[model samples]
Target: FNKYQVTAKPFFATDSCISCGLCEKACPVHNIRVVDKPVWGEFCTSCLACYHVCPQQAVQYGKATRNKHQYFNPHQ
Candidate 1:
């Protein structure tokens, strides 16, 4: 699935977001944009550190993720 790499949908930083910027700071690849609205860029490694560190749990990869232990890469 090299050409079909899993990508995150357009995730919205809801009001629950405290603007802590922790997600932006924690992003290893610096792919998360922390402006008025958080945007995921092409550089995203999908490490999920941002999602895990989010205090409000406002950031999400997509709608399919509802379980607590969802992982982006199965091989990893």
Candidate 2:
């Protein structure tokens, strides 16, 4: 079930991304690196922390999430 519930799919950042380190910092496993953009490592637990923590909402995981709603809960 980990494959469905969690994935290591590479995240794509749009032009709106500010290259901030929030996504990197948000990753509990340290699976993200921000060079000019975010680079995901295989250690991703698919927590989606990088996606929700983004202030620009610029993080996307393939076409499946293109139109999907992004939910961010600080309490998580």
Candidate 3:
């Protein structure tokens, strides 16, 4: 919330990510990387595993999500 385009719209990755490499581990299809930075490779499955597992919620789908809902259910 600091000098990152003030608007109702949320701009993820507009801030510095901690780069913990959690997103890499969460990718089931291995279509992501966080070596120097977050990189997308090939056609993603849109699983959102990377998004849900992200500890800091840094991984995002543009303004498409607010990290509010999820599909993964450990109980199931």
Candidate 4:
């Protein structure tokens, strides 16, 4: 769980991010705060809601997701 928390932390690409605050709004647990970029809080559930909700795909979880595609299920 500790490793998961560390590695699963979401970060934003400065160039790609538009600072829309959508990631903060998408976080169900309210664990994300966006000032200039999204900041991960200790209470994050690692549900990846922020990653999927990003319009620019700027949210990334380490190197694993940096180059991958993002999918947002609008039905949810």
TM-scores, one per candidate:
0.71, 0.78, 0.65, 0.80
Model 4 lDDT per residue over 20-73, tens place:
999999998888888888888788777788888898988887676867888867
Flag regions of model 1 displaced more than 4 Å. Answer: 67-76
lDDT (0 to 1) per candidate:
0.69, 0.83, 0.63, 0.78
Best of the two (1, 3) by lDDT: 1
- Which lDDT tens digits does candidate 2 get at residues 1-76? 8767566675789899999989999899998999999999877887788887888888887775676777777676
- Tell me the TM-score of model 3: 0.65
In lDDT terms, which candidate is top? 2
Worst 10 residues of 1 by lDDT: 64-73
- For residue 52, what is the lDDT in candidate 4? 86
Ten-residue stretch with the least lDDT total in model 2: 2-11
For every model shown, the clashing-pair count is 0, 0, 0, 0
Between 2 and 4, whose TM-score is larger?
A: 4
**Deviation (Å) of 21 in candidate 2:** 0.9
Whole-structure CA lDDT of model 3: 0.63
Model 1 per-residue lDDT tens digits across residues 8-46: 454556677877888898788887888865778777666
